[model samples]
Target: MHQRNISTRLKRRRAGDPMREFDALPPELRRWLAEASLPWSPRSARRIWRQGLKTGGVDEALRRLESAEVATLKRDRLAQL
Candidate 1:
């Protein structure tokens, strides 16, 4: 519950500003966000920034992290099979 409140406050405070959100997150999450964004070209990254204006950028980043984790798990499982 306490952690949830902290996350909520962080989201409310940062809103659409992904850089601020990146700064506020713990090191691991910040690293993940950076890695996920790294594949895009500058123009594509700018488009992401504009899109994030409507959807909370941090939320999108977290989703990206989740996606990467799921993909890794799937790959590992397939290798075992």
Candidate 2:
């Protein structure tokens, strides 16, 4: 239930050069990108990200988002039923 200063983490990430140009992103965009990189079941990933927001880091949050996006894409593909 603790909130980490994501800005600080981002600054560190930028300094480390693990990611280039993330500095220009808004927090929401950054979070979304992080989510897009996770490997999990779509629904489960969304749930995990929601939970992670309560106590997890940005990386964890991103993984969940990624899963959720995948799930959504799959669902959409199936919707032409």
Candidate 3:
């Protein structure tokens, strides 16, 4: 079994994207990502992180916004159908 540091795990999850890319993030960003109930793979956390960054640094906030947008789009399209 390969033991890896949490950061390495996180990096892999981000598809090996350099952490320097997210240097603008606060220290809490890593802790928040670690605590989030995402799938065990680093890839899942990376996806959340990417989305969170896109939505301005709050993972849950970004998820909610994305979910709302998706739901709204689905509803609109269904209505058009």
TM-score of each: 0.35, 0.40, 0.30
Cα lDDT, all candidates: 0.45, 0.48, 0.46
Clashing pairs in 3: 13-42, 13-43
Off by over 4 Å in 3: 1-57
Model 3, TM vs. native:
0.30
Question: If the candidates were sorted by their lDDT against the true structure, best first, what order would they fall in?
Answer: 2, 3, 1
Residue range 1-81, candidate 1, lDDT tens digits: 111111111112223656554565556454544555223223333444445435766667456545554564455557667
Estimate the overall C-alpha local distance difference test score of candidate 2: 0.48
Model 2 C-alpha lDDT per residue in residues 39-81, reported as the tens digit of each score: 2233343455556676777666765565655675566556645
Error of 1 at 1 (Å): 18
TM-score of candidate 2 against the unseen true structure: 0.40
**In model 3, how large is the Cα lDDT of residue 8?**
18
Per-model clash counts, in order, read: 0, 4, 2
